[model samples]
Target: MANRFLSDLDPTTAWAKAAVDGKLFTCGELVRHAAECHLRDIRHGERRDRATPQRTSDNMQWIVNAVRSRTNCAGKILIEGASFSSSRNWVSNGQAAAFDRLYGPAGNIAFSPHSYYDADASGTDASCVAGAQNRLDPPLSWAAVGDREIFIGEQAGSGLDAVCQFVLPAAYAKLRDHPNCIGWTRWGGARRRGSTYAYRLDPSNYQTGEDTPQMKLLLRFLAQNP
Candidate 1:
């Protein structure tokens, strides 16, 4: 059986349906019971910092393997991290084994360790680089899959110049050697709603809108290097 791509109608509901249809489960009763047990454990954990019993059937790996064994899902299985989605942190403990057991060794799938940046406090390039490096440390396999040292976030008019010229390239220089470190993309191509931050990297104020000076610099670098 090939791997399946399963997401939620709602995750809990989807899990129940998948379990029943796959025949690993005979009825929704067991599935709902398992979910209730899991939620109770989660709620208990929030109230007291004590250990919670693990749900045997609803663990992501169990679902992944069951669906993979039964369905024709061939795409990469994007999993929510253990912190939010599962009782156990499978990736931290045994990522390779967990993924292999579920999806097999075809190497068609990749894992995305969700990482983000908050520029509200305003950080320097060095600080941003350090932060990204820290995030990349544990999820090293993402580098093999396709990770980059670029920050993709919202920026204002002048901010784009700052990011492209100094911030991004500096970070890229730090981590560009890794093959999976592809590149960065901005969160929004243009400013939505209303913002003082010029959406156009090169607006009328500048000669070229999208092809700003920073972009030229980037293109030149790519052409020269590549």
Candidate 2:
């Protein structure tokens, strides 16, 4: 609708006018506009990752700094993708150290590392071997700097075995004491179905199943500790 309405006018002028008018816009529209504009610019420019190098770098840095600023100011921050350093380098250099140094008063920060515990357990290597042991600990890792609480946002949640269940109690017990280190939260909260290696509430129907019982259990554990 917005695109069609602006079709009769200059696209650039229309966008600027809409911004100046303070027109109500949804987040989805903003993302759509950004993606379309970026894609178009890419198509028109040199076909390279560094196409529009300065503008692209500045935009990305602006986003990263804004998020980092917010995280530094907040009491709790949830992080992911640090473990898989291979895919898309999520954490920036010195960012972790900045978080650690800045939040040194009450230890109010948490770092959640991602892992597939079951897969690691089945592995025969040394590194994978240790991960198999850490699986004995809660999959989530929370780090407190000063009074700040930091927690990992996701954890392995597939192929349940006795060892996997065993790690929860001690991890939650420690988290309970911090008064800020809340219990580990499930990534998807068991929403998917037929996710044999993924986290889901109902693995039975693989479509519609009540994972309420499992969620209720998690809630109870958090309430007792938090």
Candidate 3:
């Protein structure tokens, strides 16, 4: 998928020629792609194994190199080091140094970590764990120590309770106030028809155009920050 995406952005490729004719993305625009390197534990016929942190770091390095080599794209890659299975501290455990080596004086790459306030640190639940707002503190500190940029590429809470009202806002504010943190992308929007996902951001009706409680909370934060 990365190869295909990069090829499409290569100006010399046929796909790029066709896209340019159709007025697609220009080479000057800052293109960003997220590589969600989630640690996976696979089970096959009673055999169970999980991806090693070293392997994850190597894969992410490959993506960073690939993106950097595409000089024509003028892009950046958001490399994820944390997910449901692996907590935010995964970046500090040797992966940060590995990424620093790959980045190597370049400014186009940043660490992209997912944050959730649930009991398992997975966004699947609506209720937040205790003191969930401070969950990203360690990872943020690690990023600062490495002088690395961070982008929260995916984050969301399911309910309009404390998870959305308190925890989500506080966590987002941390990202906003942190100098090393660049930005964040909220998850749970743009669902397909009839989908029952908990974090869907659609309004009740197109005419009413009422923001969901979660959206309202996020928008309020944006207003204050802006």
TM-score of each: 0.39, 0.42, 0.70
Per lDDT, the best of the predicted structures is 3
TM-score of 1: 0.39
- Which tens-of-lDDT digit does each residue in 101-214 have in candidate 2? 332233333444443334433221112122343442232222332343434344433324344444443444544555545555554434323344234444345467544433
Question: In candidate 2, where is summed lDDT lowest over 10 consecutive residues?
Answer: 81-90
lDDT of 1 by residue, 91-200 (tens): 45444344433333323433433332223212222122223333334444433443322221222222244443454444334435655543333323343322333333
What C-alpha lDDT does candidate 2 achieve relative to the native structure? 0.39
Cα lDDT, model 2, residue 161: 39
lDDT of 3 by residue, 1-226 (tens): 2334235433334444444344455433212222122212211211232344455556667655655665545566677652232334445555555555555325577777777777777676777765676767876787888888888777777656754577777888888889999988888656452235656677746688977766777778889889
Pairs of residues clashing in candidate 1: 3-73, 4-73, 147-181, 202-209
Candidate 3 vs. true structure, TM-score: 0.70
**Which parts of model 2 have CA positions greater than 4 angstroms off?**
1-81, 84-95, 101-116, 119-142, 188-198, 206-226
Global lDDT of each candidate: 0.39, 0.39, 0.61
Candidate 1 wrong stretches, greater than 4 Å? 1-59, 82-107, 119-134, 141-165, 170-176, 180-186, 189-226
Alpha carbon lDDT at 82, candidate 1: 33
Residue pairs with colliding backbones in model 3 are: none
Choose 1 or 3, whichever is better by lDDT: 3
